[model samples]
Target: MSALILKDFYVMWKQTKVLLIIILVFSCLPGAFYPTFAVIYAAILPYSAMAYDERSKWDQLAGMLPYADRDIVLGKYLFGYLSIAVAAGLSLVIQTALTLFWERASDNLSPLSTIPLAVCVGVCVLALTLPLMFRFGVEKGRLVMFLIIFLVCGSTGVLTGISSDSLDGGYYLSLALPAAALAAVVLTAVSIPMSLRMYRRRRA
Candidate 1:
């Protein structure tokens, strides 16, 4: 599983050097949404990795290798989880720097608070998308996944904005953070089994 994840990481680094640079630039920007976007982008990296795998017919190759089917599927999810963690960590650092050093900073952006929500969003997205990618090919799965993400993110953003305006910031964070984390955990637990089944079907 570790080796599989490392392979995906290597592929991602090779292909997304320029994209990472762009994400870094955006991470340093002023808006809270930028950090969230970075986390979301990181979550999707595994899907891109799967696209490369599909193009090269890596599943056929992987089946001939000694790795188990479960490991093969789980590695992709673990890669996504790791990517979200790294992105969220980076975003927190940037947010902290902005909070402490940026003189014109007006928003009450709590660095710690942003991480849970960003992670939640990223994990939820991966949980929803990965099984689809496993069952269908990456190219076909991505269109539907993208649409789902667009609607969810759009609605969530609007609701969050309304909540922030209506409630105390700390009060909202206190409620929202734990709820988001719990949801992510639940969704991930459910997603892995589904993905494992899908991969087995596809490989067969």
Candidate 2:
């Protein structure tokens, strides 16, 4: 498991640094872009890493190696969590700094809501896509990824448009954010076994 994760990290080191830089820079920008980009970074890095694996035929190579199906799946999930944590932590720090220095920054943004929203969106999207990636490989699964993205964004737009007036209260974060985060976490949890099953079936 550790070896698998390290390999992923080695492959992802350059991309991860670039993403962190983007996250920091995006944090300095105005509006929801800060949190949104952080989540977007998390959503993107896993598939990018998978591209390296796919190109190298990691799946076939991994079969001959001692790596277990569950470990392979968990390694991918860990990579996603680690990437998300790094991006989220850095963004949170920058966001907090900007908040402290500017004082009225909250007037310009919605961190409480936005932070969890980003987590939910990013994590849930990744969770939704990864099992399919395991089953179909990244290249084949991208169509599904795009469809899911369209649906998610479209649904969000429709909800925002309809409930713009009602969702204004700060409590929405207190409510919606937790629910979304939980859903993301649950989905990710559920996905692990699904990915393991699919991956094992392929190898068999």
Top model number, TM-score: 1
**Per-candidate TM-score against the hidden true structure:** 0.89, 0.82
lDDT of 2 at 187: 93
- The C-alpha RMSD of each candidate to the native structure, in angstroms, is 2.3, 3.2
Best by lDDT: 1
Question: On residues 68-87, what C-alpha lDDT tens digit does candidate 2 reach at each position?
Answer: 77888888888887777776
lDDT of 1 by residue, 1-204 (tens): 899999998988898687677657756766555666676667777877898998888988997899999899889999989988888788788877887897765465643455567678778888887888889978777686675568446634633463355256567767877887798899889999999998888767
Count of backbone collisions in candidate 2: 0
Instruction: State in Å the error of residue 2, model 1.
Output: 1.3
lDDT for predicted candidate 1 compared with the true structure: 0.76
Give the alpha-carbon lDDT of every model. Answer: 0.76, 0.69
Model 1 earns a TM-score of 0.89
